[model samples]
Target: MYQVLARKYRPRNFNELVGQNHVSRALTSALERGRLHHAYLFTGTRGVGKTTIARILAKCLNCETGVTSTPCEVCATCKAVNEGRFIDLIEIDAASRTKVEDTRELLDNVPYAPTQGRFKVYLIDEVHMLSTHSFNALLKTLEEPPEHVKFLFATTDPQKLPITVISRCLQFTLRPLVVDEITEHLSNILNKEEIKADQDAIWQIAESAQGSLRDALSLTDQAIAYGQGAIQHQDVKDMLGLIDRTIIYDLILAIHQNQKARVSELLMQFRQQALDVSLVLDQLISTLHELALLQYLPELSLKYSAEINNKIMQLSQLISAQDLQLYYQVACKGRADLQLAVTQEQGFEMCVLRLLAFRPLQPNEILVSQTQVANQPIQPAQQPIAQQVQSIPQVDEVQAISPEPETVSAAVDHLDDEYYDDDPFNEPSAVQAIEDEQSSDDFLEQELESTVEPVQVVQAMVEATPVQPESNADQIVFDPSSDDALFGMDEELAATSPEQEAEKYNSDDFLFDEIAPLAEPALSEQTKIPVQEVKQPEVTESVATPPQDSLFDLSSVPAVDAVETSTVSTMPQEMIDTALMPQDILKLQPQVLEGVWTVDKWEFWFRNSELSPAVQELAQQGVMTGQINAESIFNIPKRYEALLTQLQHALEQALKSEWPNTHFQVNYAEVETTTPYTMQNERKAKAFQRASDLLHNEAAVKDLMQNFDGEIQNIQLK
Candidate 1:
C-alpha cells in the first residue's frame, strides 16, 4: 500500500514538530527544571499543531527510558506509547466522551500510582466539548492531581472552558505559521520528496494556506500530484480557484481606460471558467489595495509571488493612487454583497460593472503645463509662451474660450432689468396716484350725471312745499354724515356708500346733539323729496337688462354663511371668462383678501380646494397665525396645514436638520395619532424588580439551595 504524504510525514517528536519553537522551549525547560504543573492546556486555531503538542507533552512525561525530556524512540515504552499500546499513557477524545459518568470513571483512577513509567499521562483532545458536569468532575483532579500523574488538555476554543479549569492549568497558545516560515518548510519538504516544484508554486501554496502548516503541506502535496509529480504555478492556481494575476492586471487596465467591452470580455471569461465569484471579488480588492499601497509607499514590501509582483508594479504605474483607493472600497463592498445576490454569476457581473462605472478616465496624450499669467489667477495661460506659435491654434483657442467676469456680470444685470420690467406693480407711486385720480373723477362724473335730474326735481319740490310739508321733508332728507342714518340703512347698501365722501364733511356739531343728531334729520330730509318720479323711466330701462348681461345686484347679494357645500365656486364665471387665464395656474389663485366675504368669494370657494377647519383657522386666526401658516404652507405644504406644521417642526427638532424637505411635502400624509406605550421598557423594569425581590426573598434562597444541592459559597455579578 502507498502511504499518503500527510501520514508518512507526521512529526515523531518535539524535535520533529515544525514552527512551534516557543511551545517546545517552554515544555523542555519545565521538564528540565522538574517544576511540571499537574495539568497543561494547548490552544490554537485549526491545523496549527495543538493536538501534536499535546501528544508530545504526554510522551515527554511518560517516556520509557526513565522520564527524560527527550524520549528515546528505541525503547519498548516509547514504542508502546507510539503504537497506542501503553497502559499508562492514555489518549482520550474529549469531544466523543463528554458525559459526566465518563469523566468521573476516567478520573477515578487518577489518584493511583503509575504502573510502568515515572508518571501516568492523560491527553484529552478538543476538551472544550466536554459537558458542564464533566468539567466540574474533572476540575478537582485538574486542580490537585497525584504526584505521579499528568493531564494535558487541547482545544481550539478556550473561552468555552470554565475559568476555574483554565486557571488551574499551564496554558500554551500555539501560533499560526507565517508565510515565509511555511514556504521555507514546504521547500524542504518538497525537496525531501524529490518533486520538481517552482519556487513561485511553493509560495502560492503557502499564501493560500492562510497560516496553517498542515494545510500548506497538504496543498503542496496536491499541487505536486496535480502537476504530475512536478509542481508548477498554474497547477497551484487551478487547485486554489484563483484567477491569474495577469488577468486581474488586464481587467484593472481596462477599467482605468474606461473600456467597457474589455471589462465585459474579462468577466465573461471568468464566468466561462466557473471561478468562485466571491473569491474573484476578493482578489480584485486585494489587487486594488496593493496598488494603493504601492502608490502611497513605493518601497513597501510585498509577499506576492514573483509572477504577481511584475503585474502589480505595472498596474500601480497605470492607475492613480486616489482612484485605486476609491475602487478598493467599492470592490470590498461588492465582495460583501456578492453572497446576498440571487446567483453568483449575477453578483460577479454586477461587481465588474460597478468597477467599470467608477474607474477614472485616462489622461489625454497631449499633456500641457498650465501657467499663471501676470498673477491674475490662471487663465489657461494662452497655451504658454512657447506654444503660442504652434500650428494647432491652441493659443487662440484658449483666449477665445475663456469667459470674463465683466461679460458675465453684464448679462446677469440685463436679466435683472428684464425681471423688474415684467413686474405689473413696479410703476412709480406719482404715476399711480395720477391715474387713480383720473379714474375716480370719471366715475364720479358718471354717477353725478345719473342722479342730477332726480336731485333737481327733489330740490324744486322742497322749495315749493308748504311749512308742514317742509317739516316732514326735513325729517326725510339725509345729510349723509350722521352715524344713525348710516346704521339704520340695510347693511348691504350701507357698505356700498362712499365713506370717503363722508370723511370730507365736519361732524363735531352733528355728534353733540342728544335728540337724534341733526345729521340724521338732514340726511332724512334730503331723501324724503319726491325724486322717484324723475327716475321711474330710467329705473324701468335698467331693470329691463337681461340677467346674464347685468352684474349681480350688490345691494341684494347676500353674505355667505359658513355652511359646507359640495361644490363651491368663489369668483363669478363671467369674471374668469373675461380675464386672461394666467400661464401658471398655481399663481392665479388669490393668496389673500380683506374681509370674510372677499375670502369666501375668492380663494375659499374653489371646487377642489382643500378647505379644512384647521387650514381655515390658521388663515384667519391673527397676525402670528397668518405668518406661521404662510411659512408652514410654503415650507411644510399640506392640506391640514396646522397639524402638518406641528408634526414637521417636531420631527425636524427631534432629528435636528437631518430631516429631508421632501418628507414634509403636501402629498406626504400625516400620522393620525400615536399611542403612549412601550413594551420593552415596561418588561425590562418588571424583570429587574422581580430579580431584586428574588434576591431578598428567604423562600427563593432556600429553594435555590435545595435544588442545587452544592453549597452556595457566593453569588457573584458574573
Candidate 2:
C-alpha cells in the first residue's frame, strides 16, 4: 500500500530534518558528549517534529554502536526502531492512556532491563494530556528514572503541564519553520518522489501549512491527488479559494487610473468566484502598504512573485504616497468592519466607493470659474450688505455735542493734521523750511508726474496714512496732563491755549516737512496759518519745550484711551451677574449614578476622572456609541487599533469602575457621530453666535454706536 506523503517523507535521522538545526545541533552535542539528561521534553505546536525528534533520539540512545549522535541504521536495534518493532523502546500515547493506573503500570515496568537494545527507551507523546493523578504518579519516575532507561516526552502544550513535572525534564522549544524553508523542503521531497510540482503550488501549500511541515506535506499530497500527478498554480488557487494576483493587480490598476467601471467589473469577477471578500481586501491593503514602502526603499526584497513585482513597480509610480496611505487605511478599516455588513460584497463596495471618493481629481474634475457665477442672482442666505443690516437694531440719532478742545494735548497726537485731517479745518502753515527738504531730481520727478497722475498719487498717500484715533467727544479730545509729564515740562507749558498751539505749529513746520511724503500736497504760498485772533501768548523763553516730539509725546499709550482703560472691568452688569450664578456642585459618591450616559456626560466625568495614560488615550480616541443593557459599544479610529489589544482590558476595567457593573465592546470607526470633543466645539460655537447676535441687536448698544459713531470690531463670549 502507498503510504501518505506526511509519513513517507518523515525525517529518519537528524541529517534528514528539514528545519530546526538548533534542536538538532544541541541533541547531537549532548549525545556526542555523553551528557544526556534523564528525561527530555520536546514542546511545540502540532506537526513540528515534537514526536519525530523524540523517536530519533530514542534510536540514537538504543543503537548497537552504543549511545551516539549518529545512529547505525543497519543494526537490528536501529532497524527495529525504524520498523516500529523495537522490543526495548516503548512508545506510549499519553493522550489515550491518561490515567493514574496507566502511569503506575508504566512506571512499574520502567525498572526492567532491555531485552535486546543496549538501553530501554520510553517515548510518551502528547504528555501534557495526562490527568493530574497520572502526572503525579509519573513525576517521581520522570525526575529519577532507572539509569538503564531513557525517557523522552513530547507535548504540544508545555504550559498545561505542572511546573513541578516540567522542572525535572530537559526542555527544547521547536520554532515554527518559515515559508521559504518549508517550500524548499517540499520541493526536495517532490524531486525525491519524482512528482512534478510547480513552484506556485508548492508555495501555496507552504503558506497554507502555517509553519507545520507535516501539514505542508499533507496538503502537498492532497494537491498531487487533486491534480492527478502534476501541480499547477491555477489548480492550487482554485483548491485554496484564494483570489488570483492578476485580479489584485487589475483592481489596483483600475483604482489608480480612476477607472470606476473596471474596478466594478473586477470586484464582480471576484464576487462571482465566491472568494472571501475580507481576504481580498487584506491583499489590497497589503499590496498598497508594500507599494508605499517601495517608494522610499525601492530595493526591498519582499516575498511577492515576479508577476506581482511589475505591477507593484507600475502602481508605485502611478499612486502618490498620500493616496496609497489613504487607500491602505480604508481597506484595513473596511476589512475590520466586513463582518458588521449584511453581505461581504456590500461592505467591499462601500470601501471601494470611499477610495474612489478621495481619488486625486482628474483634469476634467477640476472646477473652472464661469460667467454664470458672476451673473447668478444671490440667494437670501448670501444677502447684500443692506439686507444684512436690515435685521440689526436701528440707532437713534444723537442730539448731544461736546465742547471742542482749547489746546492740542495727548489725545490727538495720533491724529494726522496735514491736509486730509480728521478735523477737516485744521490746516497749518506752509513754511519755507519745509520746501528745502524736497528732492532735487527734476528728471525723475517729471517722469513720475507723467506716469502717476497727481490725483492717484494723492489717493495713494491717503491710503498709506497712519490710522487715526476714533475722533469722538466720548473720547477725550485733548491730550491729558500726562503729556506734560512725558515731555518733562514744568507747569508753564501745560496750560497753553489754541493760539499758542498755532504759533507752536508755525514753529514746528520742519517736523511737518518730514511727513510731507505721506500727504504729498501741492505746497501753499503762505508760510503762516491764519489763526483765530485771540491774544498772542507770550513766549515762555524761560522753559524751552524739550523737542518737537515733546508736543506729540503719546508714546506711553498704544491707543488713545489705552492707558485710561488699562484697569477697566471686563463685562457689563447683567452679563457679570448672570455668569457669576453658581453651578450645581457634584459630590463624589461610592455608588454609580443612574443617569443617561450621553457623550456630554461621559466626557464630563472623564475629564474630571484621573486615569492612566493608556486608558485615557483609549477613551480619547473612542466614543460610547451605544449602550444596550449592560453592554457599552465604544468605537475608535482604525489607526488606533492598539487600543483594542494592549489597552482594552484596562479601559474596560475603568468603564466598570465608572458604571460599576458594565461591559464595553470596543470597535474602530472611520468617523464618530458623537464625541465629547465635537460636542464641546458645537456648544462653544453656538454660544459665540448668541453673544454676537446680542451685541448686534441690543438697543442700548445701537444707541451708543449711533451717538459715538462706535463700531463693534469683535465680540467674544466665554
By lDDT, who's the top model here? 2
Please write out the lDDT profile of model 1 over residues 1-718, one tens digit for every residue: 9766666677768888888899999888888788788888999988888877776677777775655579888787777767678888888998899899999899888888988877888988999999999998887778778888888899989999999998999899999889988888888877898888888778888888988887887887788779888999888888788878788888888887877889889988987898887787787787788788888799987776676787788888876666777788878888888888999789878877888776543433111233223123322323432332222222212322233434333333433332335432222331121233232223333322223222223323333433221122112222222223323333323343355224312333222222232212222323543322223212211211112222212121111222122222445543322221111111234445332223222232221244455453433321111221122122222455557565445433422243233222233333232211122233344434433333433232443454445344433221
Question: Which pairs clash (backbone N, Cα, C closer than 3 Å) in model 2?
Answer: 409-479, 410-479, 411-479
TM-score of each: 0.52, 0.55
Q: What is candidate 2's lDDT per residue for 549-635, written digit by digit as tens?
A: 332222222122222222223656434322221110011113333444556556655666767765765575557656533667776
Instruction: Quantify all predictions' global Cα lDDT against the true fold.
Output: 0.59, 0.65
lDDT of 2: 0.65
TM-score of 2: 0.55
Lowest lDDT sum, 10 consecutive residues, model 1, at 537-546
